[model samples]
Target: MDASLEIRPAAAADAEAVAALLTDFNGEPVDGPTAARRLAALQGIETVLLALRDGAAVGLCSLRVVPFLSADHPYAEVTELYVAPEHRRQGIARRLMREAEALARAQGAPSVYLLTGFQNETAQAFYRSIGYGDYALAMRRRLI
Candidate 1:
């Protein structure tokens, strides 16, 4: 672990760096201005954590602490987690996860969840190594 590494909540100003990390994670380009705007708009509705090493953004994790309409306690879902290829296996991802879980705990969330792509075996394995296992099947549809 790098002594200078810092992982903290993302601000609108950090959107560009966060976006770059997200884009790299998915191999999709993220628009800076748009992402910044979205970060501002989603302020309280979402949480995005940015990891920096020596003042350079290297990875990111985003999650949501969600309230349900019915009879269950609020829960958390780690929507994204990405560490730059060069930074993998450095304990950064695990540290980010620890912070995320702490935040979730502080928010009164009793459980955390995440879904990795079916083909992303590496990610699945990583999550499994962290004690996250398959829970339920998730299905989605395009309303449009």
Candidate 2:
């Protein structure tokens, strides 16, 4: 399965594939139309990559370039990452992350940032293994 899996940047035509992966990862329905709209918007400035195996989407990762902490250190943020349950632990996420990092470096980004919720310990460990660390102090204001 790993040998046949191909990972590459997403296109508008990949909307359904990407949406399906997201839905599976989240255990809920993600609007396909919304995914398509967002994919269209990423036509240039951002990147959304998909992993396909046997012509079916198995994973995906979303990345965006943004200003970093300093003027000389623009970086990429991995906004989302997901691998189908059947495909987990096979290094697909790692590959997606590596691809994102490679593109970010080429575009002059010095780092990549990701946010994982408190209970996602596995994800935290994965990020740590890939050299990511806790840095931000998150704060929020209720809008209600």
Best by lDDT, which number?
Answer: 1
- What are the clash counts of all predictions, listed in order? 0, 0
> Residues 111-135, candidate 2, lDDT per residue (tens digit)?
7878898788999999899888999
Question: What lDDT does each candidate get?
Answer: 0.87, 0.85
Question: Which portions of model 2 show Cα errors greater than 4 Å?
Answer: 67-73, 142-144
Weakest lDDT window of 10 consecutive positions for candidate 2: 66-75
> Residue 45 in candidate 2 has what lDDT?
68
Q: Write the per-residue lDDT of candidate 1 for residues 1-144, one digit (tens) a residue.
A: 579999999988897897788788878888888789878877776799989999999888887887888637787889889999999999899998998999998988888899888998999999999889999988999999
How close to the true structure is residue 102 of candidate 1, measured as C-alpha lDDT?
90
Error of 2 at 95 (Å): 0.5
TM-score of 1: 0.94
What residue runs in model 1 are displaced by over 4 Å at the alpha carbon? Answer: none
